[model samples]
Target: MADEMFRAPVNRSMRTLDRNSFRKVIPLHAARVPENKNISKVRSELERSKDALHQDRLGSVFPDPDRDRAKSGTKCVLLRPGRRKEATETGDNPHDGAEVTSPPLYSSVLDALLEQNIIDLVPYSLYLDYSYWTYHDIISAILPEDELGEVPSGFSQVGHVAHLNLRDEYLKYKHLVGEVLIDKNPGVRTVINKIDDVGEENAFRTFRYEVLAGPDDLNVEISEEGCTFKFDYSKVYWNSRLNTEHRRLVSTFKEGEAICDVMAGIGPFAIPAGRKNIFVWANDLNPDSYTSLQDAIKRNKVTSYVQPFNEDGRSFIQDSAASLLTTTQT
Candidate 1:
């Protein structure tokens, strides 16, 4: 039942799995200790799981603001180890032992954003480098070296993802997969290489959806509508400046005027005005963002008054410039 509920996303070509009959146990062949001679199989299994892992994360890595502030514009962000360390008063082994601490993501983005210091510049996700945990490190932690060829440890293999919804909780179960490492779903799983030149597969096998901090995670309640979409830092834009500029331009247009935005990111001003039955032409430079605007238009069902354009905003307009006939023809 648990496996069914946590089943991998649907795949188009792979055989449809019987939700009930699916078994996740390691094969007896797999259990046989992999001898140096069987290293090839070990490599294949590692590659398969690794590929599946990449498919799991769709590749959105956001950066952190707090850490961005600490580094003096340096590329290095001081990451607290996964385990906290305790030191003895005596100099010998002064650093008694270390316990896992929160994982530190790479500081390149945090550093870059801080250095730029642009308003509305946000990091919706973060990418982490966890390649340090090699296959050897993973295998050693999961099995005694001698057992590497015979059979992998029961719950100590290199590539099983425990479905823990929360980040910290996921970290707790990290050892089951060999190491306690955290990385952006995409960066950790390089799907292209993992697929080994095979055509792309639909759905991911290991991506876990987690709300690190939000209305409930932060202990705050927000209106249902506000909490629907996951807030990504990269989605933050400098709308305040544009809003002011838009207002200034539109102020002179009297009560009824046609408005068009070459680059409408979220339709913030476009939707509200369009609701008043004003004609609006909203477009976006990015396909994903344009799709989002299109969705917003559909959700609001403002298609009656709002027109969408998906092509390059400038080119689309220039081509239509001569044919644009805004006034009603008698």
Candidate 2:
């Protein structure tokens, strides 16, 4: 009934109503309705009842149309009365596993309630919950097989920003998908669409991005395994996904080890290594990355072990490695 009324890809539409599905979807108040109540009676009782989610069709209400199911004591979903066209489209039974080619998508029961709500309908956003249903989960049920390419499995995040590289076909729904992500993931402060690649040889490897949702700030503070890094997410590259690798690599180096980071971007590996009392000669071609590395060194209190340099990787290795290596070894 929830899927029929709200339009979701819930169960596969059971040939026979499963007990677990019954318990999950069946509105408790509707099943308890006494006598031969109609939609009017069901609505009235549902209004007073606590589990009154939204509008009801008639699954849980009084005498089920078949009457045979009600006699058999089978709990069912609330559904509407059948008109000729509707009956033919849905078949004799709403439980017949008939599919709607295009159904409305909702993330949660509360979201549906907000749409079909009787009282207190203003803050619909507050009611939306994306835990069980993601934008992909909802859109897949509504779009045709050919359009399934539109939904992405997941996205990348740096700081509070969600970066999505959508296919050309999915461009139309970009804003919609972005909004869904913002609503679903409360931690995300912004959703950015990747408009272009990191083309220029700028130190930060900066790329073009268009803000799809939330505020415009790209600077973010990221908390990884046990490190905090702050940077302009757009101005520099920081992949939160590689945090484990940073820790894993840091673990391999023993105390008093001399480390040379030729392409250290914002001290992810270098600063963490320095925290373990290892000496680090870190260099980045990007001025922004060098500045962030300086800030992170102070923030992590590893200034004594980390030496930050703003120079090309080749120059840092050829001109500086011999002196730093000799000093650290001694």
What is the lDDT of every predicted structure here? 0.35, 0.64
TM-score of 1: 0.28
**In terms of TM-score, which candidate is strongest?**
2
Runs in model 2 deviating more than 4 A are: 1-6, 9-133, 141-145, 199-203
C-alpha root-mean-square deviation, candidate 2: 13.7
lDDT by residue (tens digit), candidate 1, 152-230:
2222111112122222322332333322222223212111101111122311111223322112121111111121111
- TM-score for each prediction? 0.28, 0.62
Q: How accurate is candidate 1 locally (lDDT)?
A: 0.35
Instruction: Give per-candidate clash totals.
Output: 24, 8
Quote the positional error of residue 12 for candidate 2 in Å.
21
Which candidate's lDDT is highest? Answer: 2
